[model samples]
Target: MPTTLPVGDVTSNGRTWRQSYAEDFTKPAALGTVASVYPGMGLYDGFQDTSGLGTYAPAKVLSVADGNLDFDFHSEDGRPLVAAVMPDGYAPHTTARVSIRYKTTVTDGYKFVGMLWPSSDEWNDGEIDWPESLTLGASPRPASAIPGTYANRHVKYDRSVQVHAKTDTTEYHVATTEWDTGIVRFYWDGELVSCTTEAVPTKPMRVTLQGETWTDHGAVPTDASGTVSVDWISIWN
Candidate 1:
């Protein structure tokens, strides 16, 4: 159930937005338990290995021993990655904001935490891919690729914006996206990074969190592997 309790607030332009959804990740059982995810959240398990192994099992709930849980994403034989999604979903044209507190130790793979419409495949949908990093080309690339950077029918007229995090992702930080009807703003630690109105998504999108190895995206897999820990996710409107 969505609770009405106060979690946090974000103020912009003299208006304060109160949190509407909060996932504090408090798993009470053992680690790696295959239990239901946080309220209003959906889990996406990846491809099953044909060698008698189960489906992609990169996601797990790790007890912080402090009465809280951390969603951990690690590599498994360099195959399918894992992700968590918002089941109810959010839409454009609403004065809303979603924020995630997370950190990653993936130095040579991909990690993303934001809100988008894509699930297991390409929907060509617009995305607020904040606080994301991918190491593909000769260097690392931030998720805020130029709007219309993707080639697909759905993105032909897409308009979006993003910014690189100046802080190391190994440390916890808050990444947020504030969206209205015409503009979407990306923020890091309450600091504005990018704001644009181009190709902003018109469809409802789910909050998405993912961690994967390079091989999952057709790139060669290195020995590199790590976890992306999400402390909490909150929304305001």
Candidate 2:
């Protein structure tokens, strides 16, 4: 893969996109210290208290080597281990595009999610998840959620309009999400797989790459382990 970022502006769907952030992971480092490794990104570490799942131990679960950012997930003390990371400063964009070239080892009890999370940190605003799937036995899909009133309480309603990709996680693929006014599109290998106007987020959002146990789909086996490698990532606005 090319170690350098794409040189000029990228034109897609008649829109000119200027690259805002890019990472090739050519310099070897640990993602746990992302501030020093990649300057404009932050790592989610420490025991996760709210999610009721495994710990986010970046040092143990994430690294950079061989020109890729790698996520190594395993069971620790019967609890799942995982990592999450995102870019800082240049985020919370009302309209943006993100593309990630990545592949993974297909393990039974692990999953990955690439998402645009609301900058407001409120579920009521919106969320966009793309290239999300279990590490095994599933294809990548684009999903979205919006908050609404339920039983006199505000709750998120997952309006995941399924846009499936035929590719599996073991093969390298470029997953892209384009967010514009009143619309969101998901593409796999430059082919538009899904588009949705429902619950399109209008507020600024930030990109997050998260790897976690597939608890929502099934119970994680005690011996589950896997690796997810991101060859590179580019953001445009």
Candidate 3:
């Protein structure tokens, strides 16, 4: 996601939070964030690293029909690929919410959509990883790798509330992370899934959504490609 002001405004709790950035992928030119694609993994506020071992293809806006646009993230060589956007400003220390609606085509790879501190070296710094999963069940897998299970996490001060909850990934689901001074909560389809207060982030962070062919060791065998679709994303503070 781009680091700039959103194009619209949303009012919540008597306070108005602007739409720092949004993409339906209806028009590529209209996309506000930097795009992270193959060969080059830098853009859209994403980190740049070596390619092939585990890299991402650039995010594209596919047109399904007239006036209908959807954001697409796919990998050509079965490598990791991602399409992400960052919000314009720091989240309010008092309260804030970051939410997105998305779905995947296959269960062979890893897909993570959530929030994290932009500059933190470790993911445990004030992070909210909802709808985060390792579906393929790596060779030396974690207990959460069951077919019908999904891993959702909340991190603060390096401590995390990592839980495996049963869910269907083929269908679209709404995932959100809400936080304030007391605690951070994870939600799926409007229901609370997990909550933690240990390592809640205090600094500002950015939103990231990525789809990759991965495992505990390396890339796993799967289709030549996979995709993750985003219907919409919103933030309030």
lDDT of each: 0.52, 0.78, 0.46
The lDDT of model 1 is 0.52
Q: Model 3: residues >4 Å from true position, as ranges?
A: 1-52, 59-81, 87-95, 120-124, 136-160
User: CA shift at 178, candidate 1, in angstroms?
Assistant: 0.5
Error of 3 at 187 (Å): 0.8
For this target, which candidate reaches the highest lDDT against the unseen true structure?
Answer: 2
Question: Candidates' TM-scores?
Answer: 0.69, 0.88, 0.62
Off by over 4 Å in 1: 1-9, 14-18, 29-34, 37-39, 48-81, 87-95, 118-125, 135-160, 215-222
16, model 1: CA deviation in Å? 4.6
Candidate 2 C-alpha lDDT tens digits along 1-237: 333455456787778988788878888886455557776776777866224567788878888889889888987788888888895543668788888888888788878888898888877778888889855436888887763322344555445568679877788888889987778888988889888877688888889998877755556788878898898888888
For candidate 1, the TM-score is 0.69
Clashing residue pairs in candidate 1 are 158-199, 159-198, 159-199
In the predicted model 2, the residue pairs found to clash are none
TM-score, ranked from best to worst: 2, 1, 3
The prediction achieving the highest TM-score against the true structure is 2
